[model samples]
Target: MNEIEKKIVDQFDVAKAWSHVQHLVEKLPGRYTGSDQERQSAEFIAARLREIGIEPQIQPVDSWLGVPDGATMRIEAPEPIDIPCAPDTGRGQLISGEFIVIETPEEARQLAGKLTGKIVVIPYSYSYPITPEEARKQGAAGMIYGNWGPSDVDILRVTAPQTWTYWGLPDPDAFRIGEQEAIPQGHIGRQSYERVRDLCRKGKVTGSFSANIRSFWGKSHQVIADVGPDHLGDDADFMIMAAHHDSWNPGASDDGGGVAVLLEAARVLHGARQSLKRKVRFMFVSGHENGAYATSTWYLDNHWQALREHAICFSFTDNPGFANAPEFKIEANEELMDFALACARDVVGDEPKINVHRANKTADRGFFGVGVPGIYTRGAFTQAQADAWGGAFLGYWNHSNHDTLDKIDPVNLERNARIRLLEAVRLCSAEILPYDFRRTVAGMRERLEGWQADGRYDVSGTLALARKFAEHLDAFYGPAGTRDAARTNETLKALARELSWINYTYKGRYGQDIFGVDLKKPLPIMNSIDELAHHAAGSPMDLMLRARIRRDQNKVEDALRASIALVTSS
Candidate 1:
């Protein structure tokens, strides 16, 4: 580490950060989006920033928020019973129907027509193959997600309230092209699931499901602060360090830990502002839990021009210091993976390998559309813990009322802060933004080859472009650095932006995808390539699929060519 980085690390006070976490959990619990508590938390974060000599701006953003009131499920047939449950999302309506259990997507497909007017029960999954919207479209009255964890543990006790609305916090002015009717949704524990399932096999089963959720238009707040390079021009490049301030229940680990890290980092970085070559902006966003990243999306919309032009990269933190979490994980876009890992190794020795992954549609990843590469670092559960807990990376306490101050570890929290602080300091002080596009091109080529081997649509054209781009990148970063530092940095930034957009998003640069859906595949725009093989050639469906693939291929090619142009022109 450099002198400035070491100095910044020396100033880290985990006790101070722990105090912030305590305050958020004890004084400001239940920070639901757009609620009074959420606004108060925003003010609290702003006050903390002000205390550190960073003038923070709290911007109010209007959005749709869902607040859970209560939920209940009662079986009325084959033996009357009241099953404990947790509400996901609904409009405060009660409905009763014949109970139907579907264990997998295949079962749902087979019993599609038979599910009309019935309450369907399915296993809860992170990537829902059959979403609530599909159940609603099949004329189902309500949907019940059975907990996927062990039978002994009460999953409902730790599962937080979630929304089934695919398009979380829809655009107020945009029209819903094919919106479906809202359906009541709730979750049941494992033993409850077995009881309901066994009862259904004995005789005709009937149950009532209701969720009292308050849905309305409301306002959330974002606290933003900029430090370093006071005289920099409007278009001057800057790095973003962001974390969500609002969360479910006590949220000490979900984002309370992340907020503590961000605040402490800001305080330390502010002390070394004079040594930074670029500006560092710290952002605390709200509306992550119930609003589904609405506040972050709002910030992106309001500051598109400046962010697209001047934002060098984005680094976000979430659920940083769980008590029992021993695994350190880093998720980043390929371009930033090398630099981020180096930072991780610098702080936590290279002996314990860090688990690295490509960035996904989580955290405050709304910057993907704007072509801003991002990295998220957090302590995670070990494989044994994950397996025993039904594969929950953040443990069952995530987003739950159990996510309290007691779940946080001071030592782990301080380690996380130091790693992130080192990242921020190096990013701010670097001459050329630390980006390696060679990894980016190589990843694209590998994905294209995998698709080609599937014997699906011809990906050769895009694959060739990826190969060519790799060649250009190789020449650009030879043994000795280039003489034109300014041009080199600009070229690297432009390439990173375009390539990141194509690799992660399908809505081009302006639209937002639905929340809670998986879009982690390479070149998401062309993800439908495999579907083309299922249809017969010259059929209408086949023709439509081909046309869509061609269009998406053009998008990929345009981005590759743009990257090549930037590299060659520089």
Candidate 2:
């Protein structure tokens, strides 16, 4: 390592960062957005940024904060047994209904038509959200979500708000519950859920759910720190270091570790600011856990003009010290994966080969949702977690109260900080942007064709255009030996600039956050196609939907056509 790199790396104290993690997780009540603890965390982060010679900016955002008090569930008929309940967004009213068990999504789907008027019990370990919207669509009156982990009956925040309208914006004008328009809901532990299911097989069971909760208007803050601003003068591309500071509990793994790493990494960048060719940004966002993404939403709205001009982001999260699963899944466009791996390797020994996995919903979702090229760093996983995911994954005490300071490994935390910091540094200093959209283009084409093969919908036209787009990509990228930095940077930026229009919400607003779409879909356009593919072949009533899809397809075609012209013209 160079003198500056070594000095900055050595300057980072994992113990000191862990101390901050302790303070954030244990000393505070919880990091729910708008809470005093959350705001204090913001101040602490701001103070740290100032200590490192960067002024922190706190963007004001307004929203409603939901504070769940307590809840109780009891099986009345089978046996008068009380089941512990986790509070949801149910206004704390007692609810009574016939209990039905849907332990899996497949089961939920199989019984969707029969779930009407019953109090449905479903697993919370869903890859996709199994919301009260589905429950309501199926005619369920009340719902109970079962815990996944064996550890404890975890308390959960409002489920529906996660869908879009309520949670997508950092600060929404009014407090909107979930997009699912949910009925009364509560959660149960696995053990309790199993007992109820066993009782249900033997005979009919009746249950009641009740909770006392409070909601009120409140505000939260977004903390942003800039490093390498001198280099980011007009015309230079920039990068963002991102993580969420808010969590349901201590949240050491979910984000406490990440926030620690961010602080230290920002310090390192601050010390070596002159070395960078681009500006480096650090963002600590609130409304991540409970409010859907109030901070990100407000940011998209308030800073659209400036942000629209920026290019890429580097996101970090889930830095659990538990080294059970050595592999980490980084969500990046296929083109950026190699650079991402190289960034990780530059930091440490690089023994365990980093693995790339599809994206998931996280703090970085905001950047990727808007078509900004970004990468997500997952926390280490346990063997159990590895098997549970069946691939490279992250499963730290996500949203659980168990994510305390003690769980953090000082060494691992430091390594993660170096990985993130060095990655940012490398990206900022690199003359040419490290992204190649050819892979992403090919991947999208393959996905479209794959879905078409299933006879779900015919995407031949889109597939053909994808090939043309790939040709354009090859032409723009040219042979590496023959291309110059300016041309490469311009070409990639133009590609991102156009692709975003295809991937993001209409008019470039954060409107797509309102949908319950998978962030791991690789291509947002595919998510849209997938969202409508099955329905497109359904009843005649889908004419409007099909028409809309046609319009979307037309837009996709137009964007691709324009992108090709932009690339070839230069």
lDDT of the candidates, in the order given = 0.80, 0.67
Position 382, candidate 2: lDDT? 51
**Model 2 clashing-pair count:** 10
Report the Cα lDDT for candidate 2. 0.67
RMSD, one per candidate, in order: 2.7, 3.6
Candidate 1, poorest ten consecutive residues by summed lDDT = 171-180
Per-residue accuracy of model 2 over 14-118 as CA lDDT, tens digit each: 777787787777776477787888898899899989987899898767755566678889999977998878776567778888998776556765775897779
Runs of candidate 2 exceeding 4 Å displacement? 1-11, 103-105, 151-165, 170-180, 200-203, 229-236, 323-325, 348-350, 386-396, 481-484, 500-510, 514-516, 522-538, 541-545
**How well does candidate 2 score on lDDT at residue 490?**
70
* TM-score of model 2 (CA atoms): 0.88
Task: Name the runs in model 1 displaced over 4 angstroms.
Answer: 76-79, 98-118, 137-139, 147-149, 157-169, 172-180, 190-206, 533-540
Clashing pairs in 2: 160-178, 161-178, 164-514, 167-292, 169-294, 170-293, 170-294, 170-295, 171-294, 325-381
